[model samples]
Target: MSYIPPHKRQLKDPVSPSPFPDSLATKVMKNTDFKSSSVKVNIAYSRDAIFKWFLIGSKGISDEVPPSIKLVPVSSDSSDSRYGEKSFVLMNTNVEKENVIAEESEEEERTRWMLIAEKVEKDLVVAYEQAKKGMQDHHLSDNAKLRLVARFGKILFRRIHAGPVTEYWQAKSSNRTFCTDVPTSFIQNIKSKAIPSHEFCIDLEKEVYVVQISHYTRPHSTIICKCTVKEDGSLSMYKAELNPLRHLVVDVSCIDKNLDMRFMLAGKRKMFTLTEKERSNIQRMLDSVTVDSTVKGGLTWPHGKPPSENGYTIFEVCHVRATTYKNKTLRLRVRETNGYSERFGTWEVERGVTLILQDINTKLQEQNIERGCVLEMLRDALGTIWDFLHCDASLT
Candidate 1:
């Protein structure tokens, strides 16, 4: 009778119950064509609402939705029901593929660095061999020899700074040792509380002497002073070299006791007695050491382990060939850890001191050589050249 909509007419007959049961009603609603509805609403929103309702009914309704279930908008076309599901599957597949690509790129980068490091190591070894041969050649002038040695030093310096090739030599010579230790003590002061500084000198001659002094000293500190024996037989200083020690590889022994201490600097042995204070200090450092026999240095520790109030010591035995120092024979050395000391103090210090010593030693040796004697000149020249080139610069 009245101009009522078809939806309103259906609702007006509230007194009549539906013939379908609850489960059947849900199935019929799911199968219903939303395009046939008289009410106009967002098609996508409506589909999402229906899906959410079905999920709630199956899983039991709650105030908050479950985390695992996600609602997404669907297309207006009722026939394409599986479109949203296909899109979600494609998105997941794309993410997995992207992750795989990223992983592959990272692996490739690491492999590239490894290859670069290997090349650097090979180049260093070749350069060293060439320099060694060139220095030995009598035909090559002093300038030519210096240039060759300098080129080798430059290569070594550059490789050391290069991030990829640092510490390459340690891995190559992990098993090599160039050190020998003999149990011996100083002749005098076998059991003395007070240790004198002059006792640490090994006299090469009255004019030329090799002395063991503290590694840390002022740049202008006088190491070797030229003195004249006066008429009264008193030594009078005339000339002095502010910085005399260069390219010196020191070997330390008698660590167990301070009664008689020994050190080998530039292949010359010096002996002395450590004072009570020095002995106690060294003893404290050596107490809490953790030893590893497998490593080249036979010592391992956490990187940048700071010194404690009690003191800290890391002992190592190193081979001369494995070190930057160009000593002829295989020998073992022990020394105190310095600022450059990393996990292995002996290895790190040996490598680090090379550049510093070379920069100074090359200049000093060139100035000190006399012009006349050919054999003596060659000997001195070869010795300095060997020190420059005989370094473990492998990058493996």
Candidate 2:
């Protein structure tokens, strides 16, 4: 007698049969087109499930994308409890083909940016080490050290195409990075050059050509001041001691007009209108003063308020993958919301969603999601919605 599987036995007892009907199962078996390897079926996953699975899948797979699974909202009747009006789903199917292609292109772009950033970081690190070695070995002056740093910063700024970064020393020491245009080294270099000397020639008759100091009060105010340089080298502008030359930062440049020499002072305050008939003279004068001070030194250079830094490393795998996944999910939802974009405008919806996304990002950041805690926090933030309709064993 041929052995028969227990499931195929004809004995009818108090047995828990599979949910799928025999006929459907038979059809599924017979259908040649329903190849399991290529056929993709849509299935809904709870937010918690998605977070868990994504984390696991990402870690497990090497250069392999997660299997295509469509995530829909958990049905209202599926569970006893319900939560928010907005349920997040991970639906990759609803996105248009063109949009998918665009996402792929974006992925490529991210990869390129990451590669470039990595190279920049390595180059900067080498440069920084070399500068430190030079300072240690050659006993380079503080000014020379700063100049080396400035040169390094210039390379970074030119290549990154982003805002200035804070000092590499600070960034490296703190084990953190920022995204800003102003390199700390560049600022330090300027400060090193602009050390102020309080010694002012006490000649009250010295004529110091001044620029209009009231541009804020009057736009296009080209009013020039013919003033006597005070004993303290400050110009008396309505009793306000405007230190135009001796105590100013090295950010002077000719702006707006050929005659207008715009320069920011040590404290980031501006006072403008020293000029000559030839614009070249004004440029040369600015350059000369800055060079003289930088070379000869002056009083302690005041620090400018630091530029804000909020940039992150682009090469972190965890960050990039998380960002990519979030973007994909966001795109899918955004497209769903704009289904009425053709018939009715999506202005209102788009505005509302922008706020929502901002809030979500804030929350995500608050979680302090490192690689270890990322999946856990994500799962918690996105509560579970149990799917009960289709059991794997019953389907089989």
Candidate 3:
């Protein structure tokens, strides 16, 4: 998973009255004013499903992502018996491999971004504890501290999803642990370096520099983001993805079991929709698995939006040309719709998705094509995790 924090982007200051006359990607419907001091921003969450809309699925089934927190059209006052049934439909798309791969990579980035969950949680905890003592015994002042509590609370709640989480794994000689806070700045330093949370703006004319600061925390675990403040008072949002080879620790035991095709199928009994040809491909793929042999193949996966010139726009996958069975080769992009490329509707493209297919397309043109042993293992892990999330009995 990558670091994908959604924020409103603008090209000028106080964008309430800015004329949004049918841009390429964004469709401005209701008129709203953008205030410098405060602006109302609503978006359908990419993850942490709440209310009616959850994020899209890997297979792009009934994955119609809608605006987050906004009320659905079906109200209790409706006369129809089928109340609360969603009226949404899948976003239209075209047929193309490049576009799908683009969106897939972005989604893949989100999956990898969660690897920083533990670290981010800890950092937030430290921020909270520090904020706690800042109180001067006043009742109202203490309530102000409560605001800081939301930050810490949201971090942990979002990470485990307010659900049961197996947080740590430890053995006699080796152990792994996660925390909500790791001491960074003392109370004194924090006060001085505190950058007040500002509504970030995106400036088109200025240089927008994306910095990936790895050394600020754990060499591979921590990531720091910096972007230019635009004239419209929006700062560019970041979709920081994790590089498995460089960032993730390899689990030998899990790796062994995942690579074993039989082991992967041991508990999975739940049904999945697959064409006969797709089924045949899966079976043939499993039969052909070999140690040290890499298969460079991309899954003919589906995304929510239809494919277009710039891929399917939002929730799309691309550049899925090739990947190592052992190494990751996916690229996901999260951008605004009104920017250079577009996916659909008249809304700012808050975030984007990209999927990775571990097939080395380049190798298809060559004589010798090696398969990636690790990707085989990864596909199983991803499936198992996803199945668990979707409440599939097989994963249990």
Candidate 4:
């Protein structure tokens, strides 16, 4: 008998109609172990219909293989030259786990960034929806709605570009345009929360002349006490009181060589820079006023005290002794040390002082006392008294 390999074995006078060799039955039963005979069949120059059917049959058989078997692609140029013909490479069962884990981590990072971008876009859509509903509830007409929406779109554009990632925020405040056409949804990928919000006064008015020390402009203080003359032949004193002095800009244009100063006061959702003449007058008023060194906070006694031969005097109350007087009206001892010695004069703060202090506390809270500069705190303290009373006010 002639010798024959197990895979090439054939039978004559077959008992079954099926043409599949007997060895193929054993190969299919133990699917984990594949033989060369299973893959070495002639596939070149096959008919189109036959090749299609062959692929369909192969797919069904491949399902029996383990899922962990990776089908990595082989370089076509290298494989064709080295192996005559090759397409995919079967990854080794014992391949390192670290490489697979690293690849999985990289894919996860890409997915996370995509998710963040999608979330920002969704938030922008929700904001617009809310605005639309609000306008509808207000019974805005169709034309009004269109105009408001157009304006709101501009606000949204500035808001989106205000993010830390974009360079648009670096533009000067005045130069910023309200007619921008950028859409909020386009900023989906930006980290908007990183931008800082600038703070300014709420009720700040312009052309209000007040005094401030010229630390940079001049060695001496100048008080700007210009008054606005009314049509009724009455004079209205320029009031810079109640303005947050932290955002105040003095002499930005550098116009005055001696003591040029400017005040950046707030308006409705905006700010107004004072004129050069207005700033100069305010600086003169600030320079004229003098306070004692012992006082952490003080202001001129505005209600009852008259201006003396020296200047407008500043006073501060000792809160510890405010209610010591048995009378319903308390004689609160106040320190009068503007120009005189610490105990040179005795000033009284009555029930009116209580009201004044209450108002001061409120204004201080609004200005955020902890973060206030010395000049700003002094401005608020002096302003609280200045606006409350109008006696012997002569910083001019």
Give the Cα RMSD of candidate 4: 39.2
Say which candidate scores most in TM-score: 1
Candidate 3 off by > 4 Å = 1-86, 89-328, 339-345, 358-396
Alpha-carbon deviation at 252 in model 2, angstroms: 27
TM-score of every prediction relative to native: 0.21, 0.16, 0.18, 0.14
Residue range with the least summed lDDT across 10 consecutive positions in model 3: 148-157
Candidate 2, 274-325: lDDT as tens digits: 3233233322222222111121111111131111112100010000000111
RMSD of 1: 35.9
> Candidate 1 on 20-98: residue-level lDDT in tens?
1223335544443434322221111111111111111111222232333221211222111111111100001123433
Least well predicted 10-residue stretch by lDDT in candidate 4: 49-58
Give the number of colliding residue pairs in candidate 3. 69
Provide the global lDDT of candidate 2 against the true structure. 0.19
The residue ranges of model 4 lying beyond 4 angstroms of the native Cα positions read 1-271, 299-396
Ranking by lDDT: 1, 4, 3, 2
RMSD of each: 35.9, 30.8, 27.7, 39.2
Q: CA lDDT of 158 in candidate 1? A: 8
Clashing pairs in 1: 177-319, 178-319, 178-320, 178-330, 178-331, 178-332, 179-331, 179-332, 180-332
By TM-score, the better pick of 1 and 3 is 1
Go through the candidates in order and give each one's C-alpha lDDT.
0.23, 0.19, 0.21, 0.22
